[model samples]
Target: MRTRLSRALPAAVAVLAVFSALPVSAATAAVREPVPYASPVDHPSYIVTVRRDLDPADVARLVGVTPVHVFDTALHGFAARLNPAQVAALAALPGVETIEEDGTASAG
Candidate 1:
């Protein structure tokens, strides 16, 4: 009985050590920030400013529209008269990092 107790003590200690080294759920949760709120767009055709790094070839393949101009800027803008499916497809393109409706630009 004494030998059996000694073996069980080592196994319990090893199990506790492994679990302590593993990440706790709370540690991962602390690193995440709450998502910001975005306003809704009310128009049928709205312009969107995409990330400037969006490749012309990738945009053409996914969205079928070349930007009005491309240069050294943080963002490039475009008009998209797309349905939900089209928007989702375009958003899935590799170079696209973000999409937000161009609030300042008027389509008319």
Candidate 2:
């Protein structure tokens, strides 16, 4: 009683898993190893909001990243590319209000 897609889905997933698990030959000439899909190496970008007394740009500077943009509206914040370590450091700062990923956003 299974539909074509129902039968194919598990098979496709199994094939992908098997192929992805195969070991690469060290003799192979690639300079860098590949990072698996489930885990990625690059740091995610973030939007950081600061408290009333602190400067958003200065916070970005302290983190060793340049703020792509700074805002002074109801939410005083800046956007920067942050690694996990920088994120942890930023969270510990005295006047940091909130830090969140600059996720992909779309408007209709």
Candidate 3:
């Protein structure tokens, strides 16, 4: 009984260690950049309306490629404001086919 318990303890500890190292969700682990706009209401990032076939990880990677700040995120897309240079960089990234201005005004 003692030998069996000792072996089980090591196995349990190893299992717990591995489980703790694993990420709970791909989206949950996503780290977003901060927004510098004065008013949160006026600032909106580029709207990335993705199809259902797209993976959340890929969308997150596309968001990471853009240098501008991400204000909010959704299943289909995210809102962020990017400058011309950042927009160009984002457009160049894989899986990102378009970059458009949403016409949302910036706070003075």
Candidate 4:
């Protein structure tokens, strides 16, 4: 004698209850901690490319360093000197695209 809506409501409630019982971590994205790149130089310099929408200076501040150079054209990013721990932390941050060693090239 129950209507279709009445019959489906209990099933929907049971599904919701099952999902609510799951751990919160299971519903959230895991934060990945990346390993820092190896370098011989102490406090090696790196070029950190961040998403265009993000501010390079802000990202630099999060890691407790100032950008040696800020790029807005052709690239949106910054250059900074970072220790191993800082490098790892920066690499793990959101909006960061890539982190590479800063090097010089000379024309022959």
Comparison by TM-score, 1 against 3, better one: 1
Error of 3 at 57 (Å): 7.8
- The collision pairs in model 4 are none
Off by over 4 Å in 2: 1-41, 105-108
Of 1 and 4, the candidate ranking higher by lDDT:
4
User: Which run of 10 residues does model 3 get worst, by summed lDDT?
Assistant: 66-75
Q: Estimate each model's TM-score.
A: 0.36, 0.56, 0.33, 0.58
Residue pairs clashing, model 2: none
lDDT of 1 by residue, 35-79 (tens): 864434543444455566565445644656444444334546455
How many steric clashes between backbone atoms does each model show? 0, 0, 4, 0
Query: Pairs clashing in candidate 1?
Result: none
Error of 1 at 16 (Å): 95
* Evaluation by lDDT, superior candidate among 3 and 4: 4
Error of 4 at 21 (Å): 92
Cα error, residue 65 of model 3, in Å, equals: 7.5
Clashing pairs in 3: 45-79, 45-80, 45-81, 46-80
Better of 1 and 2 by TM-score: 2
lDDT of 4 by residue, 1-108 (tens): 657997899999999999999999887758677876554466788899999999999999998988889999988999888898889999899889999988766999
* Models ranked on lDDT: 4, 2, 1, 3
